[model samples]
Target chain A: MNTKTRDTLGKVGVFALASVPLLDGIWRVTSGTRLGGNPIETLEHLSGQWALYLLAITLALTPLRTLFGWRWQLKLRRMLGLFAAFYALVHVVCYVWLDLGFAWDEIGTELIGRPTITIGAVAALGLLVLALTSPRAAVRRLGKRWQPLHRSVYLIAVMAVVHVAWKGKDGGEDALVYALVLIALLLPRFAVLAKKRSSPQA
Target chain B: MMRKAISSNEITPESVFLKRRQVLQAAMALGAGSLVGCSVDSAEADTPSAATTRALTSTGSTDFAGGENWTPEKLVTSYNNFYELGLDKGDPAKNADWLKTDGWTVEVGGACAKPGTFAVEDLVNFNALEERVYRLRCVEAWSMVVPWLGVPLGDMLKRFEPTSNAKYVRFDTVLDPDNLKGQRSSILQWPYTEGLRIDEAMHPLSFMAVGLYGKTLPAQNGAPLRLVMPWKYGYKSIKSIVKIEFVEEQPDTSWNLSAPHEYGFYSNVNPSVSHPRWSQARERRIDGNVLSAKIDTQMFNGYADEVASLYTGMDLSKSF
Candidate 1:
């Protein structure tokens, strides 16, 4: 693609990402939601939406970049994953700081006690792994194993759905939509895996 | 992409000003409604300690009491949080300005001697405002001490002169989805309907609240009219009313009919019968700077003395 066009897309990503905190801060202010109830629950809901959004965006990047054949889209994967992690970090902080209130005792009680929370914690950890290793150097170091480590994203998305389903009392269309999006994203990977296994390597 | 930061200064005093404004608005409108049923309100609020006040007047009047709990902020912020009109408990102060309160009719029908409609102005312009500190308990397990202004329910019910067969009184709200946009949600039925046993309706504590915090009931909190029963859970108090009916049989209430197991016709707060999903033992008060809370709830929400007789022989657990 042209350098000017690439430069424009880069500028757009920077502009969009920069405004996210402000956009979100405005929501909490105007929505006038009195923050009560489980902080973990609130953060989970807030971050879960963002995580799904990022996963959707990450999956979209390939389809978008391939269909448009744009190199500018390549830079977006890290930014999108980072956004996903930003939300995930909020989710974890809410769980750790607000919900558990930084008490190892309370954290252990919920993590070890509740199945939904345990699965969710693991998914958050998986996302953390991907976020930490998202750099090109990490990919280069992993070599052949990079694809397998990156594949943990699909697992993270699935666990996220289970997490939401278990916490079903909170009203929304999120869990249902996230599951459908995950299915659509994962179907192609499964089909490719099957094709690779079936083809005779000459 | 719009965003606004939550205003600082800890306690925004605007909410308190709104509550005082609400009562004044109702007091202005009270002069228009029927005057005969509201005299009792003065005895409760104005006379302080008259043992015979209960016997002095059958109709309720504008009463006031000041406890440590009576802060201007709590008075306004603790209002019934029905969001059909707006959010932020104080949204009524801003949005209720557009409500068409005058020249409105409150139709009474179904098993009544006079099945006709009366103008809301007649009741407000004529009736005296009585302020009663009624505790409002939401189905979601939060409580508020509300100083409601209105007349006794019996006085209002007697106006229509119900037929001998009338054993229940049903209230209907303005249900036009276009006008009441929150009607879109399939939560509880919109144009909310709530009912009371004929005897319960006649109870002195059961009043039709027109004003709160010594002012007119804001449009958001069921402007022009609403129900107040210190005994029942808050949902039973339907707002923005348009119709009233006296029925021979028990009428189906919105929440009760929607999910009978969770709600009941005799939805008197019984701490023993737990809501299937959550415990009703404790409630959080609406006064702001609210961080640590969880007050023990009483059976019939402390209204058993006034209302327990109605459910003398009934099983509250099954009914609830």
Candidate 2:
């Protein structure tokens, strides 16, 4: 396939995968099968989980490309990151609008008082910064600084995992699964970094 | 006037009724019913097992009818938080069959005049069961209204004639790991324990729930026996009880032990005191219809008039 056709297919694939959750969420609401008993909670959990999944996937893209020489993976990173941001936005909005009824005063207190929410707010802010700068123009504008700016995603991923771990009422089993996935995705980068530091040319 | 208003059902019972209004408000506020109440099947009736589903006397009136939003028996039975059966909300309904409640005996002792192992059936049969509709608000910010058939906890406790040394009443759930699946995981200190102050334990609202929905208790809903503290959060209502003890010192509770910062012993429904992880200011009614906006949580979960005096002069926010 030509470069343009491959790019088009790639964009289509990203949209398809990302929209699946949104559509399924919508269908669940309309069809009454997936919302469970707590609809807002169901939506909040679904969107938040999807956000974490997409964020992890986006973080994995770099290591996957370096390990397997999958250059096409580079093209998909921005889309996945933006989708993660979108879901994160939905998750936050649900908490603010649905759960809190836009109680700004209480929300302000919660943002500072509750560690779980504070961590969530910071991670969300990081995702927002990354998402806003994801466009090609912003990347060009930020130039060399863009790499470090986007690198904050690893920190954001950790914050998200911590938020889940601390907030889990029953046990941290589900949160631990995400933590394991994040560790697995990050291990390859440490190996590569170690190789660079040990080079004789240095 | 407030009591009369509540009796008149103006205040609305539990979160579900509030949720229905919230859904309506959301439909209007968001300009769409499409977003909330997404599942029609949520209202589908779960057929009771032929063996367990028997017709019983509906002896009690809906005295606590806060609104017309009584939670269905199926949802109440199926969606439970009994960790013994499992952590998942639906696990109890599926796995509780393994719990053999038949021929169960409750060991009652400590600080009381009468102290001995009593047959569960004898205790349940001793009391004249009355149906009382009470709102159950879970600490996870969910609420349900259940018409429970049971005797007053005070009536049963009074029989033992707790001595002045008795400062607290402690209850214990079934401990066998072979039957209760979650017991093996140590998610909580197994053989779950909960306690209440002597005053709180004997309050008129404190009930020893034997059954729900005009029938025998489903194994999932703390079948055979359970403590129902309507004013407090649901976890305080220990289920599948095997032991009841009167103690001088404050008894160690399972949830409070599990996460002292998060779950306090005085887990009264206080919206102001947010849980460490989530806000208790509002709750999503599990029985609410689609589009139900989250309802503001009430102080003492709308039973303030009845139980608020019990905490007089005590700092709830700190004790919480």
Error of 2 at A193 (Å): 1.7
Candidate 2 local Cα displacement, residue A103, angstroms: 2.7
Best by DockQ: 2
Q: TM-scores across all candidates? A: 0.65, 0.85
lDDT values for all models = 0.64, 0.80
For candidate 1, the C-alpha RMSD (Å) to the true structure equals: 11.8
Error of 1 at A174 (Å): 8.1
Measured with C-alpha atoms, the lDDT of residue A143 in candidate 1 is 91
Where in model 2 is the C-alpha error above 4 Å? A1-11, A200-202, B1-48, B65-68
Note the chain A TM-score of all models in turn: 0.79, 0.95
Write the residue-wise lDDT of candidate 1 on B1-320 in tens digits. 11124533224454454455457646743652343222211101111111111111113433322242542323343243565554333344344444466566888899877778787755443345565777777766667766676777788888778999998999998776665555555655666788988998998888787766545665656777888877788878888788999998898888787677768887777666666544576665654322333567888888777678888888788777
